[model samples]
Target: MSQIIDTSSRAHLLDLFLGLRPDTLSLWGKMEPQQMVEHLIDQVQYTNGKKIPFLEFSEEEAKLAKQKNIYTDLKIPKNVIFGTLPDQLIYPDLPSAIKQLMTELDDFDLYFRNPETTAIHGAFGPMNYKEWIIWHSKHFTHHLSQFGLIAMT
Candidate 1:
């Protein structure tokens, strides 16, 4: 099982975002910049009140995401991966998405102080809060790295 991100690691994730560019994400996934942004926005929405249908997983999908493998380490399943890029950037107009995600993350960090609030996998499965954070951080970073937004300096 993977560890979840705690308050201490939030800063690290924020730091990772410092120099992110929209272009670098192209290399990691087929989605275009706008699609990538929209994808992330969807994630934020999921975390917030907007509930999308849980990603239905086939036997292969479940088998692929095993106990040891972090979510970021696994390839995005074909079912959910965007098929086509949008013509325009969607997130810029939806600043609330970013704000909501940040707010939820902040709440998550604060909630962690009460050990009872341990991370619980939403639709995926069991995972500590730290693991959830790491998964999200890594997942986002992986895409950002793919797009050429953030590079190892």
Candidate 2:
């Protein structure tokens, strides 16, 4: 499954984005392909240890969320809205948007080299590098499935 965090699977995850085009239609939601890519960039940006924590989950709730989301195979339900995406494109093209997302994802390597580094996920509170990887795996899966780039498992 693409949910695995190994290098090969992560490469495959990025490859999924490479297949996206500007005209690609989502099965649900208002986000265009580039907007979705930009949305993903927003999601990844928080994991670089820069964003302030405004956790949506309480201490106990975060534990339950991580247990179900990070440690298990629970899927993000279809059409689950975090917020409506803007129609404006961040990058002029889908490729450019995806490239920026890739750059942001790679920055985690440097950010987590300290091993003590941690980041806040709005729903999962503070998480470590490995936790973020698993969170990202499922996150990419959810978005990719929305565009039918990958099957919903």
Q: Please identify model 1 stretches exceeding 4 Å from their true place.
A: 1-25, 48-55, 58-64, 71-90, 93-101, 107-123
Point to the candidate with the largest TM-score.
Answer: 2
Q: Score residue 23 of candidate 2 by CA lDDT.
A: 94
**How much lDDT does candidate 1 score?**
0.50
Model 2 weakest 10-residue run by lDDT: 1-10
Task: Write the residue-wise lDDT of candidate 1 on 1-153 in tens digits.
Answer: 132223246566545444444443355446755455566655544443354435356545644563445644443332345346556664564344344445666655665665544333344554455665666665565555655655522
Estimate every model's Cα lDDT from 0 to 1.
0.50, 0.78
lDDT of 2 by residue, 20-68 (tens): 8889999987777888888878877788755556788688898788788
* Candidate 1: worst-modelled 10 consecutive residues by lDDT: 1-10
Q: How far is each candidate from the true structure, as Cα RMSD in Å?
A: 5.7, 2.2
